[model samples]
Target chain A: MREDFQDELTRVNRTLVTMAKAVREAMRQASSALLTSDHTMAQQVTARDAEIDVLYRVVEDRVYDLVARQQPVAGELRKVLTALQVAADLERMGDLSVHVARAALRRHPAPAVVPELADLFREMSTVADGLAAKIVSALADQDAVLAAQLDRDDDAMDHLHRELFSVMLSPRWPLGVEAAIDGALLGRYYERYADHAVNVGHFVVFLASGKDD
Target chain B: MREDFQDELTRVNRTLVTMAKAVREAMRQASSALLTSDHTMAQQVTARDAEIDVLYRVVEDRVYDLVARQQPVAGELRKVLTALQVAADLERMGDLSVHVARAALRRHPAPAVVPELADLFREMSTVADGLAAKIVSALADQDAVLAAQLDRDDDAMDHLHRELFSVMLSPRWPLGVEAAIDGALLGRYYERYADHAVNVGHFVVFLASGKDD
Candidate 1:
């Protein structure tokens, strides 16, 4: 019975890792859609979000079932609970991607705001991509150090976010009010996406620590 | 041993309920500061945020410990996980309040940013307060239907947010750049707070449904 429970728990973790990967891919594609004006890619990212949503439900169900049946000890329980939180964060990340995709669709062929936003978008993409990779590595290798670094990396994203805001506020920029709104919202979505990735990294740190303290 | 685990879980739930109440009060105080331009009240809200943060960390630790030790089954696990998510959301709500308080502090006597903004602030506070109240009650009563209604209430907040943006964009509003930026950020903070409240309501629904579907 113990071995069977362990197997089930591992399965759930694997599924969560897969969901995280899918969410990361969705974010990257959505960013590409925004940068390259690829509505097709944006559409793809939007459609894939439903898949992450489905996986979220699956993981939640399985983890709860495992907890009920196995009555896992403290360490295992933390793992399952952390997995649930991570799944929700990943799902939110997917939603962020969908938001980006919708924004792209609305601004197809790329708006003039792209010049002001391109650098921030690129830097955000790198940070998001790196954070996603680290999460996967942390889970696979159980490396808490890499997970810890994610928080620091988030600082860079935050700096870029402030810079983006300053640009929006600058009177020198000739972008009209509509373009400014789009840029601001777009910046916000990126910042939020990175924030969620940092949150996932925190979960990984908790899992690696193997104790609440 | 199983009975002891159940008792401990109940204790955790009780504590979470208390923390939620504290967070809701913090939000109310923060909004009051904004609406009434009460700088002292705003400072108090900011000071109290640290307490919310501490409570959040403590609850998180307890939840992690409980899960690892008790190995709760399906419903029990969902309850704990839901509590964890709600804790994060409540903490974020507190952060939003802090943001509002900071904005209040910046404006001092409160800059008149177009007549529409005052109305928008009033509408936002009402909706945000309602959403927070509903979430706390839904969690307390395990009421899914009420939670769903809270989700609908979020739409009104979103509409007000967009309308605020429209006001900023209109040439008629002479509150030029700085006020517009402040107004925009302020609106965003309120919208985000409402969004987090809706998230808590969703968790209440999940707990009630026993299925993530």
Candidate 2:
């Protein structure tokens, strides 16, 4: 019975890791599709979101079943609960990626980022993708230390987000209202995507430390 | 022992209801502050956020302890888990309210909303506060039907959001880039606050239904 419970716990972690990978790929595809105005890729991200949603719902169901059946206590309960939160964070990641993709799709042939702001957005994409990779590693390794590092990594995205705002709010901003709106929203989507990664990482650290009251 | 667990579950629900009330009040103050340029109210919202954050952290710790010690199962397990998710949704509602308050605070001397959009924002505030109230009642009653109704309530806010965007994005927008940015972002903050309320409601419905796979 104990061995069966342990195997179920391992399966939970594996499912979480799989979901994390899917989230990272979603971000990557969405970011690339946004930057390049790759309609097909953007469409792909939009289409794939349903699958990610299904995976997220499946994870939630699994967590509920594990808790009900195993009645896991202490460290085991914490791990299972953390998996639920992490899956939620990843689910948002996927949703935000879809948001990014929709922005691209909304303006098909025309790239969402105007010329002056393209480089800034490209930088944000790098920050977001880097953080997504870190989230995957942190989940797989249960590396609280590395997961802790993701908070600092998120600061870079925040800085870039502020930088994007600076351009949008600048008196000399030539992009006008529509493009500025697009730029601001996209900057936020990427920054928020990174923030969710940090959230998942924080949950990992909490479970790793088991330091709750 | 079983009675103790049930009592703890009751305590969890009470704390969540308290948190829900706090979140509702926070939105009221923040929205009033935003519309009126009430610097003191805005400052209060910012200061009060720390307390809300503390409450959120405390609720998290309490949930962890309950889950660890009780090892609740079936309906009991679902209720405990649902409380955790609901608390999180309320926590985010608090954060979004803080964002609204800060937007007001940032433009202390000058009101954030221009005169034309001010009435629109004031209307949005009314919708948000109404939704927040509904969330609290939903949590208190565990009324999945009432909770489900809040999603439709959120549509009013979404409509207002689109109304605000229409003004900001139109070619005739007299307000320059900065004000437009403020309007756009504030609209979003309010819309998201309502969305979180919907999320809390949905969780309530899920728990009430006891439909986890």
Instruction: List chain A TM-scores, every candidate, in order.
Output: 0.94, 0.95
Q: Give one digit per residue, the lDDT tens place, for model 2 in B20-115.
A: 888889989998888899999988887888777787777777887887788777778777888878888888888888999999999988998889
lDDT of 2: 0.85
Stretches of candidate 1 exceeding 4 Å from the true structure: A1-6, A109-112, A211-213, B1-10, B61-71, B106-115, B205-213
Question: TM-score per model for chain B alone?
Answer: 0.92, 0.94
Tell me how each candidate scores on DockQ against the true complex.
0.51, 0.63
Among these predictions, the greatest lDDT belongs to 2
> How much DockQ does model 1 earn?
0.51
Model 2 pairs whose backbones collide:
none
Each candidate's fnat: 0.57, 0.59
Q: B176, model 2: CA deviation in Å? A: 0.8
Interface CA RMSD, all predictions: 2.5, 1.5
